[model samples]
Target: MKVRHYILLVLVLFTGTLFAADIRFTASVSKTEVGTGEPFEITFSVNANIERFGAPAFNGFQVVSGPNQSSSMTSINGNTSMSMSLSYDLVGVKEGEYTIGPATIVAGGKTYHSNAVKIKVVKGRAVQQNTQSPSAGGNAPAVSSAPSADLSKSLFIKAVASKTNVYQGEQITVSYKLYTSVNLVDNALDKLPDFNGFWSQEIKNNSQRVDWTIENYKGVSYHVATLKQIILFPERSGNLVLDPLSMTFLVRRAVASNDIFDQMFGGGSYQDEKYKASSAPVTIHVKPLPENGKPADFQGAVGTFAIQTAVDKSSLKANEALNYTVKVTGAGNLKLLNAPKMNFPEGMEKYDPKVTDNILESEKGVTGSREYKFLLIPRKEGNYTIAPMKFSYFNPATQRYMSLSSEPYTIKVAKGDPGTNVTAFSGANEQEANLLKKDIAGIKTGAPDLYKDEEAFYGSVGYWLLILIGPLAFIGARLFRKQQAENNKDQVKLKWKNANKIAAKHLAIAGKQLQAGDKKAFYEAVYKGLYGYLSDKLNISAADLNQQNIAEQLQLRQVDAVLISRLTDTLNLCEMARYAPVTGISEQEVFDKARSIINDIETHA
Candidate 1:
């Protein structure tokens, strides 16, 4: 009788499980055809109750409008179920027919997929204009149609340089302006262009809406916008290319209608307009300075500038050194532009110069000066002559190159003082240093013999006793904690307690590599995706580590051997590829291998 009762209970539970799994879910898109830069909506809905829902990854399209969610519960004849829906306003990049989605979600221990919907996005209908004037109210009078103010017709970017022609190493102020005559709702800026081969400075970044004013551009008046401005210093003397900066903005187009109300609201229709405006990649005719006229010490710098020299102190003791400041201040790419070459006097020790810049922007463009501070020390006591300095740059406004020079200064020497110089200056305070050194040497150094009378038992029972007790004590404490947790009956609390241990143990190996600058090791551990699987995975600091630290951190994370080895190899290759002596086919092969290892570890681990 008891056996039959157990069998009956088992059968009832199996039936319940099957009944719970019977819930079904389905979702599909309305249409798939889309025009370039047109907004469309995609919906994901479920037909049955779900414990949780999620959206699938949408790779190609951007969610411009929404991920609006809705939930509803309906009851019919005392039977009830709930459904959830999610929708997004998406935009395609180009005109095409696309398989919108089979969006998926996992809930109630089962996976559900939405229907795969196809969409065709074709070119939009032609816009028609109404020629009736507003004054022709009662008796409509025909008026010849003319294009109104449409900002969409002329949206562009312009690169305005202070001067297109310059000598080598001269500074050029480049400003990017966005001009549009179209009505706009919103616009998104794309990725910025790379200013390669030029030492550039971001002097101004406009983050506020520019107050627009009417300006006559080439005999036509239009509303103009100033987007970005920068100061560029030409590093290499050649025809360097400046790439185009592109952006996408919502362009508002008015709908032409005979009805005044329709023209007001439906004219509010908007479309995404991509603006790829840039000035022609400028070709500056860079002129090289004449060989005979150029100064032998000239370091290829050409610009208009002036210089001044000053000394912090003219009189100093024998061992003491004084500061000599040679300042060159003027306007001409002062940020990108380098100052004249400074020559250190004979027998003077100098460290790296501490550079400081204070630049501001104006209608004249970015103007600033760089100050180089040098820390100098004199070798011996003597008078020194600091030579006069010179600087040169081409003035874009004047269309000619200019130069600046500073006057020379002299220094006097006397007896040394400790405060004036760190090295070479010896005073009466030197005796205090000797007394402290003697005191430090007069101390005992040896391990203490605290256990002299205790019995030393090795390779005996006592050694084994200690080794066994250590693990036993740990096990006892763990078991006690487990028992306490079970009594409390808190699963989430228990998960939190053990999470760090498991995470740290797994991340130990990787953590070591991360600290040691091992890029391969760092990325490999990050790719492991263990953090998503095991709660106790180590918390690895992924910042500021070089390739060597990356590998060592992996070991520190205590990652498994197979993963660690692969990580180390990948890290080493990344480092080598970045700083390798030879750059060719082998470098590409190594990079490919590293990427493969990263993906393999991510998926398999």
Candidate 2:
């Protein structure tokens, strides 16, 4: 009887487990019919442990709040079940029928998709604001019943610029603020200014919630919040129009009623309505930099700037790599400026510069340093003077062209190994050239061992070993020849196969340098390792390799975006550490991160 009872208990638990473990992925919506410019909710849920999720494209909707995550777990008889969901609050921007595409999620090594949903939006009736509310001039709130034409004065968007008139390539700060005298339930961006003919950078707001403060605008109290701040630089001289910023807001207003049931059950009724607000178009008069005052070396740089040129090694072997960095520090259109043109005296191989930006964008404007790192390799031994690089920019504040010159760099190149030609090897760095020199066979020295032809010839162990070696060497040579032939067929494949191995070699050297407390050598090895790996994996020549190129190639290969960003950051960090003392990160950590980046690329590539 006890055995039968145990069997029954097992059966019951098994049934429950089967029921709880049933998995499903589905999409659900709050409502099918939504008024145009009104907001709604759509949620995608999966009854499994999710590894990653991809959101569907809402073609006609603007995302107000999105991808809010929630998870749940339940345990029955020690058998656990899991479920997770991602929801987005979206607003329809157009009056049309639209289909929300299927969303994808990865679970248990397989991808699952949720069903698509369709929604229809139609023109909505305008919301009415029941007159004026001058807070502190306190007026009781009234319910909105019908469309009111005076709603624009209650809630509006304003675009304020620091200066309406500015010179081309000069910096301008523009702030978009929201002025609302009435309450708002929900809001989403409808349209943002394109800022055409200008290079623009936004001041990023990190907070999730909008902090509103009470302010008096035009002698009326309203809640104000800055929505977006942008720093602009006119790319060309002319009249440029800044497009208006627009938003759709769900407004909550009180509705009065005289019905007996309403009076007995509640004091009043409230209604939620849809409303739209837009800022007025703004125009800026951009004047060209005065031709008479402009310096010949001006590279379209506008603002106050200082330039400094630094070379890591004044004297290095011909095959060794040299770091020539140009740092431009100041406020202005740094992003618009091009690389300073400089002539590298003949015999030097200059690769594309690795640009590093440490700029900060805020309401104050964009300011920081931009570093251009050039990896210069000298092929022939000689004395080279890279003329003092002259950087000039039009200073709007001073109304004059300012010129700054970096100390001229003197490079003396010594002869390297005759066998080591840096131009022939794209990935060769300083350490690599040394390794290449070591790889060349040299003459044997102090050889004294000799054996006479005697009894040691036949039937001896040495004789048998020598006799066997002929066949062994022949086999080894044949295998090597076959592999080399295959490698010669596709150079890309060859590089791909050897990329990780080469990266590992550089990392080994970096590790040694880290232990030896050599910051310069350590960072150089790390930088080379990362670049070498990318050169091999992406089939990009070392000469044309840069962060942008690496990102484009990796993205073409369908590699993960986050991994590409991580690799780029590692390269930047190594470059920065070579110049300045890196804080908050140890050499060991940097080494590990470089290795991990290589490993991750190998895994994903």
| Candidate closest to the true structure, highest TM-score | 2
Candidates in order have lDDT scores of 0.53, 0.76
Report the number of the highest-lDDT candidate: 2
Per-residue lDDT of candidate 2, residues 347-368 (tens digit): 7877666667798887778899
The list of candidate 2 runs beyond 4 A from truth reads 1-149, 259-266, 423-605
The root-mean-square deviation over C-alpha atoms between each candidate and the true structure, in angstroms, is: 24.1, 21.9
Candidate 2 local lDDT, residue 548? 69
Kindly provide the TM-score of model 2 when superposed on the true structure, using C-alpha atoms: 0.49
> Clash totals for all models, in order?
68, 2
User: How high is each candidate's TM-score?
Assistant: 0.43, 0.49
What shift in Å separates residue 48 of candidate 1 from its native position after superposition? Answer: 57
lDDT of 1 by residue, 185-254 (tens): 4555564545544545544322112445556777866555655566666554556667666666545444
Off by over 4 Å in 1: 1-152, 258-281, 336-349, 361-366, 390-405, 417-605
